[model samples]
Target: MDLTTLTYIVVGFTFALYIGIAIWARAGTTGEYYVAGKGVNPVANGMATAADWMSAASFISMAGLIAFMGYDASVYLLGWTGGYVLLAMLLAPYLRKFGKFTVPEFIGDRFYSKTARVIAVVCLIVASLTYVIGQMKGIGVAFSRFLETDYTTGLFIGMAIVFFYAVLGGMKGITYTQIAQYVVLIFAYTVPAIFISLQLTGNPLPQLGLGSTLEAGGGGYLLQTLDRILVDLGFTQYTTMEEGNGFNMMMLTMSLMIGTAGLPHVIVRFFTVPRVRDARKSAGWALVFIAILYTTAPAVGAMSYFNLINTVKPGEVGAEASNLLYEERPDWFKNWEQTGLLAWEDKNGDGRIQYYNDGNEQFAQTATEQYGWQGNELTVDRDIMVMANPEIANLPNWVIALVVAGGLAAALSTAAGLLMAISSAVSHDLIKGIFNPGISEKGELLSARLAMAGAVLFAGYLGLNPPGFAAQVVALAFGLAASSLFPVLMLGIFNKRMNSAGAMTGMLVGLTSTLVYIFTYKGWLFIPGTNMLPNTAEYWFLGIQPESFGALGALLNVTAAYLVSKVTAPPPEHIQHLVEDVRVPRSAKEAPAH
Candidate 1:
């Protein structure tokens, strides 16, 4: 079959499978809706958590970022994976033991104040909404390319699919659906990597292939070859970080780590398991599943970049004939060009696509005077790299089609989890916990569904006008979570004397500070041209990028909470005792009933 038909068939089958799972796993009670009735097997929940945690940011965009950013992008890998370790060891089991349906509920009960819960809900909503927008962007990108639809139309189709399953199944449906999604996405992701690795390096394992010698035109270690090619084209070497970027990298990595631990959607997955021990077990299993992809990402990124550079410049660098003629461009280039994610202009009327770093003035001058090149002639969106990698490598149509399904699966699974978190915050934490304490279970479930519908619409709108590419947008969401939620959650569990006044004050301070800093650079609410200053490194506060400012905001949160708690009254006696109990280990016989 042709690519288009195969893509339709594959994507259609996955969507059908997802909707079927949703129907079969429809939640029947509040427990099921919020935490999958707290009966999820640890292994199944681990798979579900892996699917939920690895959003389009992981499946679609992280490799894209690595393709363009080179070594500087390693922070994302380190930060996100390290952050999971923090979540597993420091937060997941303890929170699961607390026996709450939501993070806000734990804060409220732990702090003995409804006000604290409301603030926590606000933080969760903001972070989750920001994170979901990236997923929506990924969905749009995948659908627009593979389904041959406009970006807006593709986005609408994705939104409808998510609304149906997420609204119908809740956490119960989403969990099982995610397990299926995990299988599809991981298979889709690794198969292509394996193919490209064998083709490029004669190795079946992408991880090892990255270090192996190239078997094609170039006969050097893969990364060394990539570095030479990039440097010859006026870009920095691919294997080394640019000078002066170390501090920012460290800060960004720290923010991502803490933010990962603080993300409400991932934390809520732990609650789906039956016991605290099961939560820990699932976390370990989730890490294993997560590692399978994380380890493969570097290989994919390097190989994709290598393939892209070879395709665009087929001959010696800077030679007139080296540039690929615009007329002779490959089919993948034409397909992506139609999506507007890739474009070309004949600078200097050369009629050849010169994809190089025109920003390097020395290189630009040489190209202008010697090579008769006017400027960079191609624009490639980083987000397109992974989705286009298979086509760029001339992989089979089925492999390409599988990638489309994988991208959609990654985007939709996380979108469902995030929407669940948002709706639960509104329905369970706000309406039931505070506004209408006497609300019936039936009413609460209805409200949760309505809240989810509203969140999907809002998220769809934001996706239409995303602040950045998928991974960058996700990094910002991580920053929000790190600054606003991680500190408070940690304090609530570990600091027995932490009071409502301190937790509330810290959340507001951290959230507000991070927002102001981000808005100052990223624009107010991410509206283009609304930023107070240019978002450049030189203008950053102490050289901290907005995405890396979360650690500082978190620091401010901790300092403010510590000072405030010292002056204010300690938490009530029972609340203090509750904290102690939460920390104490329980044997199987002593475990609390679900």
Candidate 2:
């Protein structure tokens, strides 16, 4: 079958699988809807959590960002994965033992105030909404490419699929669907890497293949060869550290680690495990599953970068024979052109494609004076790196179809998880918890579904107009979570005297600071014409980009929370006991019934 037809089949099959799982796992009770009745096995829960955590950002955008940023992109790999350890050691088991259905439940009860829970619900909504925007973009991109539709139409289709499963099944449905999604997404991700790895190196494992010698039998390491190729094209060395960006990377990593730990969708995964031990074990399992992709991402990025350069410059860099004739480009190049993601202009009117660093003035001068090249004539969008990988490698059509399914899986799984988090916070935390304590179970469930539907619509609308690259948009979510939610959760559990007033003040401070910083640079809530400052590095506060400002905001949260708590009354004795109870673990048989 042709690539388009195969893609339709594979994608249709995956959607059927998700809808089937949703029907089988549909929740009948509020307990089932919210926490899967707390009966999930540790390993199964782990796979679902892996799917939830490794969203479109990880699957579609991370490697592409790495392809361009090189070593600087390690912040994402290390930062995102490192948080599981923090979750396992510090948060997940305790939250599981607390036996709460939502994050705001834990915060409200622990702080002994409805106001605190309301604040938490707000933070959860903001963080989750920001996160879902990226997922929506990924969904649109995946659908747009594979289904050959416009972004808006693709987004509507993706949103409908998520609404069917997410609204029908809730957490119970999302859990099992995510498990299937993890399998499909992980398989789809690895197969392309394996094929590309085997083509470039004798080694099959991408991790090892990155360091292996090129298949051309040169003694030079693959990374070394890649470095030489990039440098020859006037780009930075592929394997070397970039100057003046180390601090930004470190701070960004810190933000992602803490932000991940604080995210409500991920934290709520623990709530579905039957026991505290299961929660811990599930986190470990999640790490193992996630590491499969994380370890391979750097290799994928490096290899993809190398492959792109190698394709454009087939002979020697800066030589006329190396350049691809614009009129004679490959089918893959022409394919991406339809997406408007890949473009070429004969700037020098030379009738050839010159892919080089137009940003480097010195290189442009040399190219113009010596090589008869005007400037960089090819513009390849970074977001298309992984999506275009199979095509770039000239892999079979089925593999290409599988990649579309994989991208959709990643985006949909995470979007469902986030919508669940948002809907739960609204229905379970705000509506049921504060506004109407006596709501019927059926009413609450209906409310949850409606909230989810609304969230899907809002996110789909934003997907039509994204703020930046999908991964960069996700970074904003992480920054907000780190600055606001993570600190309060950590303090609420670890500090016995933390009161509602202090926690609320801290969250407000953190949330406001991060939002203000991002708005000043990115625009007020990412409106196109409202930015107050240039987003350049030179305009950054202390050389930190808006994306990296979360670390500073988190520090301000800690300090403000501490100072506020000093002047506030300590938690009442019952709240103190509640904290201690959650802190200690119990065996399955001995654990107090929720």
Candidate 3:
């Protein structure tokens, strides 16, 4: 079958699988809707958590980002995975023992203040909404390519599919659906990595292939060869760190780690398991599943870069015959060009495509004078790297179809989880907990569904008119979560003396600080043309990127909470007992009194 037909079939099959799972595991109660009735097996929950955490950015864009950013991209790998360790050790088991349906509920009960719960809900919404915007954009890109639809149309279709499964099944449905999604997405991601790895290095494992010698008769390791080619083409060396990228990489890693631990969607995953021990084991299993793709990603990045350089320069780098003739470009090139993702302008009318660093002033002289070149002629979107990698390496149509399915799976699974987080906060925390304490279970469930529908529409809107930081918005989302949610949650559990006043004050301070810093550079609320200053390291406070500012915000939260707690009365005796009970798993599993 052709690419289009195969894509349709594969993507169609995955959708059917998800819908089937949703139908099979439909929620029957608010507990099921919120936490899958707290009965999911540890291993299954772990896989589901992996699917939920690995967003479209991880599946579709991360390898591509690493391909371009080189070693600098290690921050993402470290930061994201590192946070899970923190969650498993410091957060997950205790939270699971607490047995709350939502993150805001824990904060509210721990602080003994409805006001604190409301603040936590707002923080969860802000963090989750920002995160969902990125997922929606990813869905649009994946659908637009494989399904041959416009972005807006693709987004709506994706939203509809999410609504079907997410609204009907809630946590119960989504958990099983995500397990299926994990299988499909992981298989799709690894198959291409294996194919390309074997093609370049005679090794089937991409992680091993990255370190192996090239099969193309290159003189050194594959990374060494890649580095040589990139440097020759005036790009950063593929394996070495480039100088002067914005932000401290360590600090950036910490922010992402904290953000990962703090994200309501992720933390809530632990609540679905049957026991606190299961929560701990589930976290470890999640890391194992995630590491499969994470370890292979660098290999995919390196191989794709190697393949692109070799395709464009089939011979010696500067030779006239080395460039791929514009008219003779492959079918894959034409295919992407139609989507406007890959473009070329034959500057100087050379009739050849030059893929090089045209912005490198030091190399411009040699490029133009010696080679008769007129700067770089091609503009390939970084987001297309992984999607295009299979075609670039001449992989079969089925592999490409699987990639489309994988991207969709990754995007949709995370989007569903985030929407669930948003809706639960609105319905369970805000409405049922505070506004209408007497709300019936039936009314609460309806409210949750309505809240979910509204969140989907709002997220879709944000996807269309995305912020300036849309490309890097996942990192920003992490920042917001780390700053606002993680610290407060950690304090609530570990600091029994922490009062509602302190928790509330800490959350507001952390949230405001992160937002102010981000908006100052990324535009006020990311509005176009509203930035107070250019988003550059030179203009940053203490040379921190807005992405890394989460660490600072987190620090402020801790300090502010501590100082405020010293001046305020300690949490009531019951609240202290509640904290102690959460710290140690109890048999009764009842909510402690206020």
Mark the regions of model 2 whose C-alpha exceeds 4 Å error after superposition: 217-219, 586-590
lDDT tens per residue, model 1, 7-37: 9999999999999999999998999999999
For model 3 the TM-score comes to 0.96
* lDDT of candidate 2 over 455-523, digit per residue (tens): 999988778878988899999999999999999999988998888888999999999999999999989
Better of 1 and 3 by TM-score: 1
List where candidate 3 sits over 4 angstroms from the true fold: 217-219, 244-247, 372-374, 468-471, 584-594
User: In model 1, what lDDT does residue 108 have?
Assistant: 90
Rank by TM-score, descending?
Answer: 1, 2, 3
Off by over 4 Å in 1: 586-590
C-alpha positional error of residue 226 in candidate 1 after TM-score superposition, expressed in Å: 0.5
Candidate 2 has its poorest 10 consecutive residues by lDDT at: 585-594
lDDT of each: 0.94, 0.90, 0.89
TM-score of every candidate: 0.99, 0.98, 0.96
- Collision count for each candidate, in order: 0, 0, 0
Worst 10 residues of 1 by lDDT: 585-594
Best by TM-score: 1
Best by lDDT: 1
